[model samples]
Target chain A: MVLLEFSMSPLGKGESVSKYVSRSLDIIDKSGVDYRLNPMGTVLEGEWDEVMAVVKKCYMRMRKDCNRVSCSIKIDYRKGPKGRLSSKVSSVESQLKRKLKV
Target chain B: MVLLEFSMSPLGKGESVSKYVSRSLDIIDKSGVDYRLNPMGTVLEGEWDEVMAVVKKCYMRMRKDCNRVSCSIKIDYRKGPKGRLSSKVSSVESQLKRKLKV
Candidate 1:
């Protein structure tokens, strides 16, 4: 199983970055894995080297002090079955019968 | 402007997904948006809506035949600049005093 959506920021660092994206979401919530934080980016499952070692430790904690960093990664390697992050959006809202703003 | 990186896949489509991925790439190529495809995902640079529209089209394309689809997206919105796709990496390499594996 693999999901691994990612987003990193720090170019010039002036534009309200939510305090460096809350310090890389506090290092991906202490790297416990099985994450999902929407609004585009931050979804991790497991395996694939434990979600790429938690995205290389959130890009070495935003490359420490932020000189110019911008990371955007996306991976979706599937095998048999595992939680496809809310069952792949409930199978497209059960074929578009309703509910999708997730 | 924004940098969007996303990946989508059809579940149970039998492991090798290059065919589906190729289809999506074709769509992206035709959209005339600046993009870079990497091993992890495709990076697109454009206005937020422009990039997102491309992603939506890809999802719709995959949803046509695949019963279950999974999409992972990440966006980095920045102001006062553009062309972060290659520049971002070059900046890092410059600081590292060595080239990175792209």
Candidate 2:
């Protein structure tokens, strides 16, 4: 999974992030890709390349038309089935195995 | 001062925050408001109403045209000049005065 965030100077009027996000969604929809956008102003979940491509285009369009740009992206590995919950299993298992051996 | 952050679902393709930020700036500039948007995917500083109005409009547009929406808004009192410092200074002065009297 990848998480990306960006902030830039709102050129003349000094608007808000919500405005920018809405515009980008339109572009992504037109480009034909599967993704989910949350109301919290965050874009989450999608295939890597496709998502990146969409964001890049949107970022470019916004930047070209605005002044100053800043962005951040994070990608984390996702495990299958109980993906988030299982990471804890490893530590629990190790502790259990040690106790059993003792 | 007000600080606002919105993370939403990007409708069709999952995009990053940078894509959204660039777009807002343009609207702000055209609208004629004074504000600054930071690169950390945060919109900071601006006249109260203008910033809020722009964000609301932008947010609605994104939500109406997109799948989901989530946003966070924060308003803080900017201490003039910081005008006052919270730390060793005030206490130090008190201590010094006491010691001098002693």
Candidate 3:
């Protein structure tokens, strides 16, 4: 499975870009990829096509309304099973042996 | 100031939930606030009202199309100036003095 972490926002969109970010997310929603929203970016878990396609669509959609868009992406592609979404966090928590406070 | 990290999704969606998540993000975008998109959840930086307002809107908007929605939220409220977004991460990086790979 491929795990992708990414943030996309339009440049010169003022102090807050939640509105534009929301539109980009619409594209991701229609792409049919499993995703978890995070504090920094959204984590997408799927095959290469499913994950990259969503990222590509988000960038494309943002371009229509905003002149410049900034995207930060980090991808972890593994040739193994799925369900790493929760498992990865669980593993880290297990090592700490304490529930994450937040 | 207030910092919020959250994930919102519709229950009973298939394995992939990009679409629903995207819709939720739309509400967040319209909210006039500062935010960062992360791998686990989107982080919003603002006063209590601004931050929570966005969360409230996202939850409300998502309920329109999704029968059941799940949300995870974490907040860090501090009495200080703005700009914790990069500073928080930068502080950690400074401690290690090693650049984050991704």
Query: Per-residue alpha-carbon lDDT of model 1 for A1-102, expressed as tens digits?
Result: 888777777889786655676566667766788776543356788889998998888888788888889887766777867687676654544544444333
TM-score of each: 0.58, 0.34, 0.52
lDDT of 1 at B33: 90
Name model 2 segments beyond 4 Å from true: A1-13, A79-102, B1-102
Give per-residue CA lDDT, model 2, range A18-42, as digits (tens).
3554456556556765433321123
List per-prediction Cα lDDT, in the order shown: 0.72, 0.43, 0.69
Error of 2 at B89 (Å): 45
Evaluated with TM-score, which candidate comes out highest? 1
Model 2 / residue B18 / CA error / Å: 28
iRMSD, all candidates: 11.1, 23.4, 15.1
Q: Which is the winner by lDDT between candidate 1 and candidate 2?
A: 1
Worst 10 residues of 1 chain B by lDDT: B93-102
Local accuracy of candidate 3 as per-residue lDDT tens digits, A35-58:
765435568899988888889888
Worst 10 residues of 3 chain A by lDDT: A93-102
